[model samples]
Target chain A: MGKHTVVPFGPQHPVLPEPIHLDLELDDEKVVRAIPSIGYIHRGLEKLVEKREFKEYVFIAERICGICAFGHGWGYCKSVEGLMNIEIPLRAKYLRTIWHELSRIHSHLLWLGLMADGMGFESLFMHSWRLREKVLDIFEKTTGGRVIFSACKIGGVRRDIEDSELHGIAEILRGMRDEVREITDIFFKEPTSVSRLKDVGILSKEAAVATCAVGPMVRASGIPLDYRVADTSGVYRELNFTPVTTDTCDCYGRCWVRVQEIFASLDMICQAIEKIPAGDIAVPVKGNPNGEYFARLEQPRGEAFYYVKGNNTTHLTRFRVRTPTNMNLPAMVEALKGCDYADVPMIVLTIDPCISCTER
Target chain B: MGYLSFAGTILGGLFKKPVTTQYPLKPAVLPEELRGRVLIDIQRCISCGMCMRKCPAGAIVVDRSAKSWSINRFACVQCATCVDNCPVKCLRMEPQYAAPGTVKQNETFVKQAAAQPAVAVTLVKGVTPTASAPATGTQAAAASAATAAKTAAAPQTTPPGDGAGHA
Candidate 1:
């Protein structure tokens, strides 16, 4: 047995895009335990709901996390809309679902690039991001903003994608499918990546459920727990959405799930475009929302929960967001146990931790 | 799983042109739908303050008494809520972003009193400009101008608390 050494890992690290600090207890280069300390980037976004009107708080919600901006906004709107008993038009739901799927593809690509970068594969990282740029271009062309798309409003979507434009977006995604497959194939087939990922950071199904893991983390552990399956708010049911799962229960499995999700999201977007009904995008919301509702959404990373309480006023009484990263932290810490100290970054990245979302 | 599995991609990438543009050297491509900066047509502004009321960032200030609208570009989140809520359709989202500045300053657009006669004519045609209560259009316009001059002469006061004062 070696002497224990405590190594403080971040708030700043090369591999981490967001600031998150972790104290790793190491015994001769093996991590005995990883103690995560968050709250580095909390913006108190939920508190702003009191200041901004219920209608306007969607903008604040959208800013919670840049990568999951659309989901956050949609979740907030869904909660408020539910509170107000407003039923949005069918076309609006379809449009929102399409944008959500598009964002999922972009987000997964971004994670793949970051994962490659974390694995010290610079070229693969660049290639992954290069593919991601096309998705951002699609976002810019359709929703205006690449990262912070304010297309979602309280009652419904702010802008409508013309049927032809929707078809064009679908065609663009289809065209990129081969290229995406080519890039993602390297993650699976490349000897170095396989060695780095496979059999590393193993989180058993029991441990995953015990730690309350969400999103790909749970899916990677052979659990088909996807909020999209249960969520009635979006058109996921209409599209016949199914959660992607794998039994590997390691870093590789997480990667595999995310990569598969990229393709699944693409297919879902195309399906939505084909089946989208033509109708009014939004109906006028007349009065203030006066109730409390909890809205759950399937973000690219995981399941996000939004709780909103409105007291018959323009301002909401309380707004709370439970991001997927927050739920996955315990599972992440559990996975980190007995991991090589060198593999800590990889293990942490496997959770796709968005500290901003968690802290917000 | 071969060690050189990526070698083919590497060699092919060398032959291919770089996917990224030179950006500044190549004047980056911008989409038409890009939400960049808020612009106001002062001539058409009714001083109704809808933009100010709707701006989530509290970046806009509409002074009805002064017949002026001002936006702090640094504070604006570029959400285009103001553009959507503008009653007179005076607000627009220009694709060109405001140039970065060393100092934070408010860009003020004051409706020229000369343009008021046209607005006054529209107001008098029973259009019921939402800016103020019902009154004879000519007198109301003159009174607003007088108040504008009075407020302009006085030291500037801070705009009301975001959306709270209206309620």
Candidate 2:
């Protein structure tokens, strides 16, 4: 019998952008179990609702995760909007979708780069991130900030992109399709990439559903459960949104799903730009929001839920965000069991962990 | 699979220029819409304090008494809320980001007190009558001068003589 040993993995691992500690129980070279401990980066952001006015809370919400800043900002606004019953303009919805999809593309590209880096593929990581910079350029050109957009407001959006500029953005994304395809091809055809990813951290459909995993984690396991499809929120429905899922239930499948989703996001953005209506971008929202409302969004990692309760005052009574990584921790533990210790980072990267969002 | 899968892509990149440029030496061209640093046009500032109130980071400080506006660049989040909420449109966002510095930069914009009208002297005398107050003559004169300068620049609905009743 092999002696069991506990190995603590990362609050400051080179691959991780945010802090999250995991204690892995190992039987020789195989990981027997993984116990995750969160809260290293907890800033008590939810409690700030008591102090900051609901209008100003959007800015704080955007800070939850720099990668998914637009999504967090949009979700907070959506919750408050739902509570206040404020109907945003049609143009605002289209604009939000464009920015959100752009965010999705950048995030996926970032994950791909990080996954490559984690797998010791330096050139691939650099190539993927180089492509990602173009997406960030689009973001900076339209929304003003590469990471924290700050373009989202309570009732609607803060700025508007001209149709010509939107068309220009569409052209850039169209050009990106070939570059992304090239990188994706390398991941698929390269023996090194396949050897590292394939047959590692396999999660069955049954176990994934049981663990209540969300986003690409479950999607890669063959469950087509996408929050964008399930919730029917925002302009996703109007834009012919489609969820990309795979039946492999492995690390490679997860990578494939994310890459495909990036293409899907690009298509969605182009379609949104094509069908965007001409109208006011924002509506003046008056009075404090009353009652409680829940806003769910399909963030880059997965479905992020925001629950907001307001008391008819500037200050909110309660506000909370349940990020996808928080939901997938149990799934990560399940995936880690019986896997080679060397595959820990690959398996963890497959879930696209965003500790900042989780701990916030 | 072949011994080398990256060969084609690697060969293709051999002739292409590097994606990254020499930054700081030759300035990278920023997008027109890029939100970098906040700049204030002091001449157009009305001291409405909207920027200070709306700034989520609390980076802006507007001193009403001194008629000065200062922004701590490090604390500013570059959210542009201050620029958007500025009533007079005095605030603008420049595309050039503030250079990293050892010293924390605090940019203060002070609007020189507007030209005091000649009528301000007589109006100040009416507003503060020294007959009943313990204030010395010099103190009264200085206080009245400051008040007179403020009153002259600001819009008025009633004549300065209305304060004569209070005096």
Candidate 3:
């Protein structure tokens, strides 16, 4: 009778935290084309760049995303340093790498928990979140905040890690990996999990690339475009970059890529810490920045984009951020094609969407 | 291999303790140097505006004339800028983390830090607190004399809040 039955997906849909909505056009219980609607949690973070001082903008930038505060701080610092042509100390660079990888592991752990819950795998969800608590405990003990860790500042990180802390990190990671691998193995082996995920919400490489899908989403489609491996910023040069992907391009594939990334992050962290150099944490940056610059870094979900322009004043002129979730929304819609109505939330959860980062 | 794996899984299940603590009863201790609770040693506070100027959260109000400082527990972020630059060393950062309310406007976490008691021992030349005071005072000053070095190394004293004492 009707051309299609349209269903509103989210903003308060149990799947995501930050608000994001999708109108699904369904034909006989099958999603044909999904239309994504965003911008619910936009706080005008970019606008603050014009009002706050350059050095202090790091604080605002760190709030761009809560789960990955270190990533935000590192990205903003990298951007400002790029404009000033200032080279951070080797020790600072290694510390940033360690922090970034640790954040990635936590991000993936959080996603795994959510994904498990999304597919009705409650035990796995509890297991992952519980394991993630250890990481947060480490964060609180090492850097301070459990969520928005205000650890990274303008030039370097706020604190230094001692040998005992590094040992603690490596030991915990080793133990956590075993539990994570067990859950992952069970996820792939269970028939119910397979029935829900294996072939659902597929996005081919062509659609993925054209839609500018990023992070594990693109990798799931068989595109090897990881910013860490392709990165020449020298911060990630010493650490190995092994891109992981599966050809299924389905929810399972995306989930698998993220799972594999946890292992990759562990390896990177272990290496970065061993090669750490000792020096002054923060370098002396005399004055404010005066120029226009855009910087990009890989977030746990995908590629996070940052843009800042200075008017030679205490405050910046214009600042804009295009988060990875925003870039992948169109592709997420495409991925939902041919997916069953019941699996919509699972498909969305697999993307690990942080709509706050997206809308910011 | 299957039997061995199952056995290992069973063993793992029995040995691992639950990661989370019993909430509301079993409280945890946060680490030192943590930017958790905002402290203000009111007596040592010099009414200096360094903290007020640097606070990104605008949570501190220094009323020099009133000889008083107040902080809005609801507005602080615990960023620790006040503690870092307190020239009189009055503001101290500690590991007291607890938000008592809801909404960004309702997160009440206020505390009062009294003025630090300074021991009035006689000042000695060429003698300093070992492993404490850096050479910044010596090398930086010896390199450039003639300027009064009276308050050269006094840590700035800032009073209460992470910066959000609105009243």
Candidate 4:
């Protein structure tokens, strides 16, 4: 029998991009249990809905998480639009989908970089971020901001990409595909990386379903649960969206899912640009929204749900966001059980926790 | 299965130029569409208060009575909501960011009234021209001159507090 010792990890750690604390109960060099405590970066953005007008809250919603800013803004607007019964233009829908996919590419690249850094592969991390810079350049050219894009509005989008610019962006993304393939190849084929990732932390399909995991976490465990296929929002259905999955249910499987999803996102963006029709980008929204509606969106991390309740006024009565990281925390705790103490950070990184989004 | 699989990437990187720029020595390459900071054309502004009302951060204050507009640059989120909502098209977004400052201060812009044309001074014996003949053109000119003088004398007072702070 081994004596158990409780160890506190993070709120501030080199591998963590945002603040989250975990109490790890370790028996010698192996973790037996993990207890997570959040709320260090809570900004109370949901309560701001009562003070700011429903139309103005879109900007606030976009600031919830810098990585998934566009998705959060789109999700909030979709909820309010559903509440008001305002149908956006077809062109607007296609533009939103394109921007969302671009964000997904950048986000997955960022995650790959972080995962590499967590695995002690510094050069791979740098290469991943270097490829991601091209996507940020595209965002700056189209949406006016590199991080927090204030493009999504209540009724439609604020800006439109000309056909020539859209084609140019598609060309750039096509060129980026080869560079990304080169960087990701090392992760899959390199002995060092594969040794660290394969079968390190295993979360079985039943346990994943029990903890109610979302996004790549569940997909890696052979469950095809993705909001892009389940929900009819945006133009994903027209693009023939399919959830990427694997049966390994380990850290390497999660990495493979994210890498495959990045390629899938690039293809979806190209398809959308080809099929996009020229029309009005935004329509005039009239009157206040008066009802409650929930909007589901497939963020780069996973499924995010936005709930908005309006009371026939300029301001909404309630606004809530159920971020994917919040849903995956229980699954993370479950996965931490019986893992080597040295593999704790790598196991946590596989979930791709966005504490800012969760706490907001 | 190779341990040295990443060596080729390292060798290729040694020949390529560095990706990062010398930021402080050379100015950053800013995109044309970058939302940096808010700029206002005081001449074209109608003092309609649309920017003050629509600013989610509450960083702008339009004093219609004094014909002045003030914005706390530190409190602004640079969302360009003011630029989009401006009815008179006076507000715009400049790509250059605001210079960093040690202390917070409000940037106030007061519209200057155009110069008044010369008016002939007529004298009356029985009634005072200023008091009795209020409807005359000369009276209107005199009243405008007085108001313009008052506006010229008004000090550029900084708004009391940035409302609600940055969002």
Can you write out model 4's per-residue Cα lDDT over A202-221, one digit (the tens) per residue?
99999999999999999999
- Give the winner by lDDT: 4
Q: What are the per-residue Cα lDDT tens digits for candidate 1 across A1-360? A: 998999999999999999999999999999998888988898888788889998888999999999999999999989988988899999999989999998899899999999999999999999999999899999998888999999999789999999999889989999999999999999999999999999999999999989998999999999999989888778988885789999999999999999999988889898999999999999899998887898899998899988988789888899999999999999989999999988898999999989899989
Give each candidate's fraction of reference contacts reproduced. Answer: 0.92, 0.75, 0.33, 0.79
How many clashes in each structure?
0, 0, 18, 0
Pairs with backbone N, CA or C atoms under 3 Å apart (clashes), candidate 1: none
Worst 10 residues of 2 chain A by lDDT: A228-237
> Whole-model lDDT, candidate 2?
0.87
List ranges where model 2 is wrong by over 4 Å: B1-19, B116-167
Off by over 4 Å in 4: B1-19, B116-167
Candidate 1 residue A278 Cα shift, in angstroms, is 0.9
Higher-DockQ candidate among 1 and 2? Answer: 1
What DockQ does each prediction reach against the true complex? 0.71, 0.61, 0.36, 0.64
Q: Write the per-residue lDDT of candidate 4 for residues B61-148, one digit (tens) a residue.
A: 9987677999999999889999999976889988888889999999999977645564444456785334222233322222344444
Model 1 docking grade: medium
Report the TM-score measured on chain A for model 2: 0.98
Q: Summarize candidate 3's per-residue lDDT along A1-360 as a digit string, tens digits.
A: 435888888768776756788888998788988998877888898887776778777888889888767888888888888777777777877777888888898999899888888887899888888878888888877887787777776776777888778877888888887887987887788889888888888888889979999999999989988888765543687877778888888888888899899998888787777777778667777666789888888989888887777766778787777778888888878778888899888888877888888777
The best candidate in terms of DockQ: 1
Which clashing pairs does model 4 show? Answer: none
User: In angstroms, how far off is B147's CA in candidate 1?
Assistant: 21
